[model samples]
Target: MKYDWILFDADETLFHFDAFKGIQLMFSRKGVDFTQADYNQYQEVNKPLWVAYQNGKIDAHELKHSRFLQWAEKLGTTTMELNSAFLNAMADICTLLPGARDLIDSLSERAKLGIITNGFEELQDVRLEKTGLKKFFEQVIISEQVGVAKPDKKIFDYALGKMNYPCKSRVLMVGDTLQSDIVGGINFGIETCWLNRHNAEKEEGLEPTYIVSSLVELKKILIP
Candidate 1:
C-alpha cells in the first residue's frame, strides 16, 4: 500500500445508504405508507439540512430533529424519537457496498483503517457491529461527537489526533462526496480518492488525488 492509513466515509462510500428505503421502513412501522412523493417531499427539507450541516451552519441535533419535524407533528411523536427510529431503520437495513469487504480486508493487511463520517453516532456503531467491520478500524470519528462536519478542517484535525498524528503524506482519505471528503483531505494536506460511482460532474476548482468509478476500480488502484 502506498499509504500508512486509509480513512473512509461511512455512508454511500463503504455502505449502502438507502435513505428512501429506510424512511419507508420507518414509516411502515408507524402504519404509514411512505410513497415516492412523500420521499420527494421529505428530501426538500432533508437535503438542505445536510448541506447546512456540512457547511457548519447547523449542528447535528438541529439537522436530525428539523428534517422530521413535520412528520413528528403529524404522527404525534417527538422529533428525537422519529430521528432515532430513522437511524435504527437505517442500521437494520445496512449492507456493505459490493466491493467494500474485499477492499477493506485487502487494505487491512497493509494499512490501518479508520472512518471519519458526518453520519450520526447511533447508526455508525450499530451498522459497524452488525456488519462485523468494527474490528478492522482503529478510529471511527463521527462529527456528531466531534462538534464539526467535514469540509471544516477541525474534524480532520480531530481525526488526525485520534490517528496519533501520522505523517500527513502517508494518509489517504476515500469517500464518495467531492465537497466533503476530497476537499477536506486536500485542505488538510493529505491525498484523497473520490469514489465517483454515479459519474457526477467534478466541482469547479476541486480535483481529487485519484478518482475511481467503483470500489473494484479503487481496489485495483491501491492493491495493484
Candidate 2:
C-alpha cells in the first residue's frame, strides 16, 4: 500500500445514512405517522442546517436543536429530547455500505484506519460498536467533539495530531463529499480519493487525487 494511514468519512461513505428512515422510525416510536410530506418538511429545515454546520456558520448543538424545533413544539417535547431520539433511532438502524467490511478488513492489515466525520458523536460511537467496526479504527474523530467541522483545516490538523503527525504524503482520505472530505484533505497537504458513488458531476476547481465509484473499486485502487 502507498499509504500508512487511511481515513474515512462515516455517514454515506462507509455506512448507509437514510435520514428519512431514521426520522420515520423515531416518530413511529412516539406514535406519530411520519409521512413523505413530513420528511420533505424536515429536510427543508435540516439540509441547510448541515450546510451551515460544515461552513462553520453554526455549531452541532445549534444544528441539531434547530432542525427539530418545529417537531419539538408539535410533539410537546424539548428539542434535545427529539434530537437524542433521532440519533438513537439512526444508531439502531445503522448498516455498513457494500464492500465496507471487506475494504476495512483488508486495509486494516496494511495501514492504520481512522474516521474523521462531521457526524454527531453519540451516533458515531454507537453505530461503530453495533457494526463491530469499532475495533478496526485506531481513531474516530468526530467534528462535534473537536468543535470544528470538515473543510476547515483545524479538524484535519486535529486528526493528524491524533495520528501522531504522520507524513502528510503517506495518508489518504476517502470520502463521499467533495466540499468537505476531498477539499479538506487536499488543503491539508494529503492525498484524497473521492467516492463518487452516484457519478455526480464534478465541480470546477475541486479535484481529488483519485476517484472511485464504489468501495470495491476503491479496494482495487489501494490494494492493487
Candidate 3:
C-alpha cells in the first residue's frame, strides 16, 4: 500500500445512514406511524440543516435538536429526549455499507485506520460498536467532540493531531460527500478518494485526488 493511514467518513460512506428508516424505528417506539410522507416532511427540515452543518453555519447539537423539534412537540417530549431517541433508533438500524467490511479488513492490515466524521458522537461510537467496525479504526474523531465540522480544516487539524501528525501525502481520506470530505482533505493537503456511488455529476473546483463508484473499486487501488 502507498499510504500509511486511511480515514473514512462514517455515515453514507461506510455505514447505511437511512434516516427515514431510523425515523420509522423511532416513531414506532412511541406507537406513531411514521409514513413515507412523514419522512419526506422530516427531510424538508433535516436536509438543509445537514448542509448548514457541513458548511459550519450550524452546530451538530442544533442540527439534531432543531430537526426533531416539530416531532418532539407532537410527541410531548423534550428535543433532547427526541434527539437521543433518534440516535438510538439510528444505532439500532445501522449497518455497514456493502464492501465496508472487506475494505476495512484489508486496509487495517496494511495501514492504520481512522474515522473523521461530521456525525454526532452519540451515534458514531454506538453504530461502529454495534456493527463491529470500531476495532478496525485506531482513531474515531467526531466533529461534535472537536467543536468544528468538516470542510472547515480545523477538524482536519484536530484529526491530524490525533493521528500524531503523519505525513500529509501518506494519508488518504475516503468519503462520499464532495463538499465536506473531499474538499476538506484537499485543503489539508492530503490525498482523497471520492466515493461517487450514485454517479453524481462532478462539481467544479472540488476535484478529489481519485474517484471510485464503489469500495470494491477502492480496494483494487489500495490493495492491488
lDDT, residue 18, model 3: 87
Candidate 3 lDDT score at position 41: 91
Worst 10 residues of 3 by lDDT: 125-134
Model 2 bad stretches (over 4 Å): none
Q: Candidate 2: lDDT over CA atoms? A: 0.95
Model 1 — TM-score against the truth?
0.98
Model 2 over residues 59-175: C-alpha lDDT tens digits?
999999999999999999999999999999999999999999999999999999999999998899889999999999999999999999998999999999999999999999999
lDDT for 22 (candidate 3): 89
How many clashes does each candidate structure show, in the order listed? 0, 0, 0
TM-score of model number 2: 0.99
User: TM-score for every candidate vs. truth?
Assistant: 0.98, 0.99, 0.97
Q: Please, what are the lDDT tens digits per residue for candidate 3 over residues 47-151?
A: 999899988898888998899899888979999998889889999988888899999999999999999998888888888788888899999999999989998
- The pairs that clash in candidate 1 are none
The sequence of per-residue lDDT tens digits that candidate 1 reaches over residues 46-142 is 9999999999999999999999999999989999999999999999899999899999989999999999999999899899899989999999999
In model 2, what are the clashing residue pairs, if there are any? none
lDDT of each: 0.95, 0.95, 0.91
